[model samples]
Target: MISGALGAAIVATLAILYGRALFTPPSEIDGEPLVAGAARVLYVIDGDTLQIEQQQPTGVVRRRVRLIGIDTPELGRTDAPLKAATADQPFAREAAELLRQLTAEREVRLELDRRRRDRYGRSLAYLYVDKRLVQEELLRRGLAVVDAFPGDSASMAKRLEIAEQDARKHQRGQWQKQ
Candidate 1:
């Protein structure tokens, strides 16, 4: 058993080391229902995900945001913990390249849904660059497919679905006949 003096010393050290984290309030995004703001894109993680930096009172906060209502071809995964590695899908590179070219180090407008974040903790948002929805561009180019969820905006989902259908009909990008 620790002496009273030793136990007090240990507690004091822990409090000094971790007090801020234990007492500071959570960020606004953690509790907000909807988040609408502009952020600078730090990098494109994939066709439908990006890292962005937003200004916060404490400092700049970097976050990963996943686009809503769309899914792009998967990039190859060489490092899997519990499953076999997988190869890139047919249009994976093209999709990722397109997204990178469009959003890298650029300012983007973010409009989040009522369900601000997904199960992965990445913000779910619709990103816009120069007033054009990036998701629609991906769909029109056949780089991504409509992947609407219950949380997605109904009208936007419909629009994305139409864009995807048109791309498919025109045999664009990933929809090209093999």
Candidate 2:
């Protein structure tokens, strides 16, 4: 077995080499404060939701982020909000699959909008993987619908609408039935 001191030294060296990579600030993504609200995506709950962990002065904070301005088909649960079967929505699994591929085990940057939280208190924000906006990509792929919530800004709403239109014209994702 390795000596205790030697093991500890190895761990310390690894931490020193990899610490910043693990706890990257949002601004470090592609530079600029525009990458603010950086966090590690712990996991994805659905196409439009993620569990993210961010460091704060007090400690690390973990919260669910809801991608605003777009809505994917519901993945209903027996005890969920007005619980019912959501499997009926076309491309429901496909959307969730795509979301998982995009966000699982990745670090993401959050850009908050006019509203910061949803009805369930989930952080309402746009997610960026690398420097690419996740919301706009989802809309472009036709995996999401522009379900504008009351708190969503007019400008963002318009942009989502335009993306949806493009997706529709191209017969992408939901626009094309399986």
Candidate 3:
């Protein structure tokens, strides 16, 4: 049985993706109605951010989601002024592009931690595609660093730390010297 919070979240997501129709039978374009913890990727916002589509009772809803447990350098997001204060680092554009290549237009499963949203109101989640974790991929490739401020569990932080360390040692992506 699904928990109440999770059930509500699922309904909310469906409403967001599908619109007021709410589970109006899966159409040809959309494979099926998504239950809780799943959504379709609309686009990649940055290395750690994504825009996802969910079905709603009224219509499809699109939302911005931020990846938990990792922090990649910036590409000057207009909506995030504080982020723009920092200088763009190595591989910033490449990191975002890689994330786009990996997740754009794909369906993903989201795993939430104890906390769901960030102070900035972006949904925090661990996204998976084709059984692979996107956060882990970024870390292993050195496109992102382990920064667990948004994560509730320490295990994710520890795992990301190890992965980032490995990427650094191997001179992966952003870890390489210019």
Candidate 4:
């Protein structure tokens, strides 16, 4: 009986240790430093996110990146006019398609500001393609709305505000009249 009790204690201790290791926070790991500069887009996840590949000590690392300062409407969100009217095709689908056409397998530059990976482990980056900012493109095309997060750099914030103004004035993409 004593041996069984001892074994159970050992098992409990081991379980606790293993659980702690498995759920270790990012702050605990010596996370890869925030990388900036140029990279190539391997794929586009949506209007505001893409997967980019960059060189690292362990060969090339691919990062799933979410664009800062933009939030596109959901594919079937009731707030989306296009989705409300069309039962067949949703605006989110169209935006994703557009992003794929623009960024898939293309070279882009990335700029990192405050945080690196979001809670979900996706890298948060400001992307540029063909000398134009990707966030601006989404806004200009009316695919996404400007939604700046805290800790954004001054210049980037200004640029995003300008892009949003442009989109609003022109009523591009989803901003267009119904």
Candidate 5:
């Protein structure tokens, strides 16, 4: 059996490591913040994904950005037969529509986390529009659930969790009883 002292020390070490990895602020390079630039949202692909035209020092670049700390229902997939669901997932359209209304053609700031890209090569970020956090809004409306990854922002995850709880308590959007 593991000793109590050793287990406590191990847990403490793990917590410290996790906190550093997930809560570290965005880095600065040459006295400028790395993700300080703003991007115009070309389109919202879904509730949590967007295509953006970002203005960089070199030129304008278009990229797909996946929102951090939240997940909405998936839209229908006709292209992939493996996950073959012809119909959209529950509340998918509502989520997508709300996202579109929130960000379409608007300038949004992308705040990046430690893991900058997902496996699919989409930029991972916390999207903000006019200083409003889109993820928190979605969670508050019950349109999304907290789906933070290990390297995503810990503070953001906490905020999202609270929003989701409030949504559930009031039975808003997808949380409404059928």
Candidate 6:
């Protein structure tokens, strides 16, 4: 009985440790800054997020970044016809492509939100390309909808609300008639 209990505890401990390592962000990477200028867009994860490649002293580091205050419909989400039509491709791919068109290879500034990285270890940042808020631009273009997770509790909800309202009013993207 004692051996069984000890073995169970050891297994549980290993599982937890592995999970933490998988989910937690790295303490430091070559190009990551607590706060820094926006680098070039390497790729977009979704309409509301992207991966940026920045040059650091050591080398280039690709950082996954989520746009503040926006969420777009999943590629195959129930309500989005376009997304559903392209079921073979992941939902985020379209958004990423659009983002690439908008900001790939362009220099932009980056601002940190309340949190630096999300549970998935992606950076949470507000991007500004040529003085434009990348998040707001995505909203204006109807590429993404507003989304605020629990980690963004400190953010100003009003911005996301307004973005959603505008997208609805304009019938942008999935909001438009199929």
Candidate 2 on 1-178: residue-level lDDT in tens? 9999999999999997688667774434323322247789878787888777876554566677789889987665555566564453776677777878887788788888877767887778888888887888888999899988776788878988999999999999889855
Q: What is the TM-score of each candidate against the true structure?
A: 0.78, 0.71, 0.70, 0.70, 0.76, 0.63
Model 1 Cα lDDT, one tens digit per residue, 55-126: 756666667789988999998888889988899998888988988888877788988766667888778899
Q: What root-mean-square deviation over C-alphas does model 1 reach?
A: 5.0
Q: Could you report the Cα RMSD, in angstroms, for every candidate shown?
A: 5.0, 11.2, 11.7, 7.1, 14.0, 7.5
How are the candidates ranked when ordered by TM-score, highest leading?
1, 5, 2, 4, 3, 6
Clashes of each: 0, 0, 24, 0, 0, 3
TM-score for model 6? 0.63
Backbone clash pairs for candidate 6 read: 38-109, 38-110, 71-145
- lDDT score of model 2? 0.77
Worst 10 residues of 6 by lDDT: 25-34
Candidate 3: where are CA atoms >4 Å away?
Answer: 1-36, 56-59, 77-87
Q: Which candidate number has the best TM-score?
A: 1
Better of 1 and 2 by lDDT: 1
Runs in model 1 with CA error above 4 Å? Answer: 1-34
Cα-based lDDT for every prediction: 0.83, 0.77, 0.78, 0.75, 0.82, 0.68
Per-residue CA lDDT of model 3 for 78-103, tens digit only, reads 56655545556778888898788888
Query: How far off is model 4, as Cα RMSD?
Result: 7.1
Error of 4 at 45 (Å): 1.5
Tens-place lDDT digits, model 4, residues 1-178 = 4698899999999999889878754323435554787788877766677777786664566667888878776554355666554332345776788778777677878888887767787788888777888788887877888787777787788887888788889988877888
lDDT of 6 by residue, 31-136 (tens): 2563577488766656766777766675566677877667765544355666544452333555656777778778978877677776677777888889877777
Q: Candidate 5: which stretches are off by over 4 Å?
A: 1-34, 81-85
